[model samples]
Target chain A: MKAKIHIMLKNGVLDPQGKAVGHALASLGFDGVNEVRQGKYIEIDLAETDRAKAGGVVDRMCKTLLANTVIENYVIEFE
Target chain B: MKAKIHIMLKNGVLDPQGKAVGHALASLGFDGVNEVRQGKYIEIDLAETDRAKAGGVVDRMCKTLLANTVIENYVIEFE
Candidate 1:
């Protein structure tokens, strides 16, 4: 099984990197951009085959290491 | 309008960050992980309403500023 994860800063959390990107876009003359937010996308190939078990493992990974639970949220999908 | 973009290293490109992450996962006692790859997820809020135009604009942003086309591949989706 493969797990794809998206980890993003929670709402109300300040993101300086996103702000920098927005400013850079404006400086590059790309108009109409109102806001920019950046996050992490991770793909993990697992030896486990069972969907439910894989999900559990990946969830643990997110909670323990992949995501900073206080400031970020993560969504996981399996394939 | 909103645009979501995922930027990833092209296949065959060495990702040291990803390797480090994989190692970390292993050290954390999470087993059965074959590989781990990391990428970027970005969200942009746009004033433009037309989907076609927004796609064009986001594509240009990826080509010019958001992605290092030489080694990174980006996919853009609108919502």
Candidate 2:
């Protein structure tokens, strides 16, 4: 199964990198852009046959290493 | 309007960062992870009211700043 993961900062967390991106966009003449939050998208291809097992593995991956629990949240999509 | 951008390296490109991530996962006992590709997810909020206009702006952003057109491909999701 292939799992796609989206990891992003929590709602209340400060994202300086996102702010920088916004500034860059503005400098490039993209006016009126706001609240630009940057995150990560990871595509993992696994050999597991069982969908349940794949979901469990991806959940563990998110909790353990993929997303920083303190500041980021992750969503896993099984395909 | 809000647009979600997913920027990723083109298939022919080598992703050392993703390889390193896979290695780290294996070290952490995620043994079944095989081909892992990493990318960037950016959530952009814009003042443009028209969806078409938002798409155009995001396309330009990807071309000029958000993504390296030569080695990366970007998908824009309008919301």
Best by lDDT: 1
**For model 2, what is the alpha-carbon lDDT of residue A24?**
95
Give candidate 1 misplaced runs (Cα > 4 Å).
none
Q: Write the per-residue lDDT of candidate 2 for residues A1-79, one digit (tens) a residue.
A: 8999999999989999899999999988899897799999999999897999899999998998889999999999988
DockQ values for all predictions?
Answer: 0.94, 0.90
Residue A73: error of model 2 in Å? 0.3
Give candidate 2 misplaced runs (Cα > 4 Å): none
* Cα lDDT, model 1, residue A65: 94
lDDT of 1 by residue, A1-79 (tens): 8999999999999999999999999999999999999999999999999999999999999999999999999999998
Find the 10 residues in a row with the least total lDDT in model 2 chain B: B49-58
RMSD to the hidden true structure, all candidates: 0.6, 0.8
TM-score of 1: 0.99
Question: Least lDDT summed over 10 consecutive residues: which range in candidate 1 chain B?
Answer: B14-23
